[model samples]
Target chain A: MESTRPKWPWIVASALILVWTIFPILWIVMLSFKRPGEVGNQKGFLPKHWTWDNYRTVFRTDLFTAALVNSIGISMIATFAGVVFATLVAYAIARLEFPGKKLILSFALAIAMFPVVSLVGPLFDLWRDLGLYDTWPGLIIPYISFALPLAIWTLSAFFREIPWEMEQAAQVDGATSWQAFRKVIVPLAAPGVFTAAILTFFFCWNDFVFGISLTSSDRARPVPAALAFFTGASQFEQPTTAICAAAVVVTVPVVVIVLAFQRRIVAGLTSGAVKG
Target chain B: MAAITMKNIVKRYGDGFPAVNDVSLDVRDGEFMILVGPSGCGKSTLLRMIVGLEDITSGEMLIGERIVNRIAPRERNLSMVFQNYALYPHLTVYENIAFPLRLAKRPDEEVRRRVTETAGLLELTEHLDRKPSNLSGGQRQRVAMGRAIVRQADAFLFDEPLSNLDAKLRGQMRTEISRLQRRLGVTTVYVTHDQTEAMTLGDRVAVLRKGVLQQVGSPRELYEQPVNLFVAGFIGSPSMNFLPASVDGTSLSTPLGRFEMPGEQAAAAVGDRGVVLVGVRPEHFEDASLVSEDKRARGSIVQVPVDVTEWLGNELYAYVPYEAPADLAAQLRELSRELDSDQLRTQAVVSLDASSLIAEGTEAALWIDTSRIHLFDPATGENLTRDEDHAARLTRAAEPSRAAQRSTQQPTEP
Candidate 1:
């Protein structure tokens, strides 16, 4: 009886969403496999002829290779530094009693809500003046600053949900403060820290405005910026397929990270370490 | 085992309000001491101060012979059971019990042996591998007890550990804790707002009100002779009844019948304060028909209309409502507000033998032992009838319980 009706509305709605989201990726992959002569070919969406030339072309360019290395290195460093700083500041905001705790939280929220594009102009001038233009440090500094607000807000909410009595219980059970935090508090907060690291990583990795505004060369330019200046192997060739292949390449790590920690991320977001 | 001493301990928050004000106490070695009071009475604050979980504004605290006023909680060598149990959710029961030993860097074999023995003692042998969330409330409480007992520290502190359990579970754990403390003979301090736990569990009880220590004595001492009106009302179950009374040359006038005060008693009642509060415990009253002639000679009888009667097979409780003047009723209401009691009715409860024929909405003759009456100064709230030497006498009497517990304790593996 329960299965008698055909659920046409949900099926149609799901089909529409699937098409809306996947069509662009399918188009990109199809463009990457198309022959050089089929560039912007109007015969059909599918390629009449397939080739490995696009992937081979992407591998041959030193600009794309160097930008890949820069993206991985810069994003990794920013995520580590941001998560560490956020954990300390979040612990203080959640647990300690000082004079101006509300002000600190308000200031962090303000920074999170600020426009990233508005700051790029001033940052560009400052980086050039400080001899930091087109450098790895130049990109990493702004990434850490922008990503810290997200990490602090997420981690502090998680820290506040922990049962504070456990700390005192640990002390009474004969543990020093440092030992109590390292053994009892850290294990409970691991999921939250991992979630915060993932979020910070995605923020730094997905950034385009700061990458383009702050860097000029392959020495420190991330993939998002380096893709815009791609060149063909010869004067008559177009770089469309090569750019498509590189875009799909840079997206692989994100998909892998999201799939690996998907369960923990969902649990960390829905239920904190606290129980009734 | 070590005795704990606090000399003039005080705690004040930033508002300049004292949570625990100038309190002094000495818990003897291997004794079970209960601190009982209403909420906001600073019983928990005092316990926290002893465990070094809280800072002392200005005082000296000693564990055995060492001055530990500035010591950390872990260095004080104490184990505490929090009200919420505070078990680590990520660990199994065995790991929770073994946490302190691991932190202390005990050998692996020793840790396993101690955790197993402690679990067996708590009757949690089948639950060693389960986490706290899977256990029942009673089982979680036992795991908390196991964690504290496995350490064998200088003392054990309990902050209303039974408060979160159901009534049956609380009753069961109360006895469990009492037996465990007796069997271990560790110097222990427990804090609770429930007076029944104080009466049944403590070798000696300390009663507090509004950050001040009111009385410290044996349960019988606090019951038979409370130090003030606050202690009198705070210690008993149906609480002692307070009624305004005026004293003439020799006789006292109250809602109850006038009674001739003995010469010395009259002098104490009439000292400085012209008016006094008369306190009568519920059990001190009896059915007038059940009293013998000789017993009647030492008591006073009053006929009151019974408002309600509850028969409990062995005993009967008859509540009699009376009229109090405007000022006296207001004062009683103020006292009730300070003590956080639910009702401030002008009623007297009389406990009579079940065989008595007192019924609701009928006038019954009730006889009270006049010699057991306590007189209090209405202004100062001081019990003029208090025995000044009771605290000293209690200390000496506590020695026998200590000796008995020591002899009864089972030997542990050294």
Candidate 2:
């Protein structure tokens, strides 16, 4: 354990990554509280005059507010549906004895491993054919389809580490497999399931290309597409602080959830490799 | 709470190779039976079958006269304690113990009462609110046991529940689980590879090897009169010493010396003198006068040159190279067992008081009582007098009385 200073190379590497990755986030946060005059052109490491106006201005925009509610609403719904469907599929694929179980799991993994860029055109065509384009369900259905596969793949790995004996113990104690899964396995796998939810939430929430391509109306558009609509042609007349403030809302929730679950998330991600 | 019987039980894995083959046993109401074997011998597989966690590939399993081959594990109402204790890490000790009762839809008051009572019994009352990860291995084992007894399950199945503990704690928990099993008396079936656990805790131990039942008997029965070569070698610590010997006329001769066989094997000898396996327990040797020319004496002794000694405080086990005949290695190998040192050098051990210790690399004959020598068939690996088939047939035809097994067909009182 003391010799875990084998961590030196990784510590240095992670420090470099932390500086690069967190720099923009820190910059955005710093800009969000800056006065309008410092919106884009302002220099200096710290804000000269910090105020709540950027936040207030972003909140006052109907476009930003609608999209905020839409993003939260869609992401939360997608997360819920993804967890339920994915957890069932994961437990089945991991624990149940069935024919072609491996193939079904491989298919889910293949979907995850497959590039999303390849599906954008095909999925867009299908959505247009189904007349779901420019709608909330339009956004939800495809996001769920994509999110479920990854969620199931990850959650199943978590479920596999749990001994089948615990379920057998529960079953012998009078729990049906479903009841055992819900009452016993789910609580045990909450940290893992939380990780899957967080990832799925961001998969849809931070999506700009798909969200913008899928919806064109305020009624069904999410915050990402709504924020994208503020740009004219190739650029926008909107103040940089307003965009920075929107970026804060878009990125902060995921960042905070990930930070809170950092330990669990690390364990969950590597859990697929081998048990520690 | 219930009697469990397995009639010709067989379990084959998905690949169709048998994990447990044609095993038959019975557990009387409230009896504690242990299924023991080396790893991959399928003792745990057998236990899982009894709990309905694994399907019986062949034969019938009855719990209280109900054939439960197709029944679910939960429906069998047997609680299992896993090797890792399998305690729910997210739940408190109290909750883990009460999990079964809660599943039964018992009132919170009832659940709380049972949990508290069980925790108090295990002396885990103070840890009731702590999670399994916070508890020590022994405490977690107690919690697993408490969960088993807290519910009125028809039976208890333990899959090496004490294996993960340290050696000292393993012994400690062995005593505790034994006491708890006796007190609860819920028809427990424990699986373990540790022979000491098999010997110390079980009412009757079922020994398995390569998916075959070797023997099932009390600890003393397995030690004093194992049915076959496998059981004899496996059941004892510092396992039995096997040396190649032949029946030369009325005497059993090896490089050590020719000694008289007990009367039972004497008749079986019948002048056939190829070679045979001679088993001598370490403790069977005594310090006799180096010269005992009267080989005709019914009770005989042998000389052993001391080699290396292991001092375990209370008793010392001395390994001796008795320099037996050249064929001893062949006999052990033929029997699918090995003790290579007995080749150009044969080995014997003497369990004695630590004070009377002999220094290593010395020539001294520790007399072996010839009457206690067990002669075995080399090719068949069976005790010559009793053999595998005869001991098993006798055990099968055995009545419930201890006398049935005491000196079975042997002309002796003890």
Most accurate candidate by lDDT:
1
Residue A26 miss distance in model 1 (angstroms): 4.3
| TM, every model | 0.93, 0.87
Runs with alpha carbons beyond 4 Å of true place in candidate 2: A1-19, A26-57, A231-241, A259-267, A270-276, B269-273, B289-298, B322-331, B334-346, B353-357, B387-414
Query: A1-276, model 1: which lDDT tens digit per residue?
Result: 378678998899999999999999988888888876677787668888787888888878999899899999999999999999998899888888998999988888888999999999999999999999999999999999888988898889988888888888999888888788778877788888899999999998989999899998888999988889887767688888888888888887998999999988887777675662
Using Cα atoms, each model's DockQ against the true complex is 0.67, 0.50
Off by over 4 Å in 1: A1-19, A33-53, A232-237, B260-267, B388-398, B411-414
Chain A agreement with the truth for model 2, given as TM-score:
0.85
| Residue range A144-258, candidate 2, lDDT tens digits | 8889888988898888888776777778777888888888788878877977988898898887767777777776778877876553112334577767788888887887888
lDDT of 1 by residue, B1-414 (tens): 899998998999889999999999999898899999899999999999999899999888999999998999999999999999999988899999999999899999999999999999999999999999999999999999999999879999999999999999999999899889988889999999888899988888999888999888888788877888899988887888887888776667888667755348546646766678888888889999999999998888888889999999989999988777778778877887777785668888878899999899999898888788788888778787765576467656766865776577756666
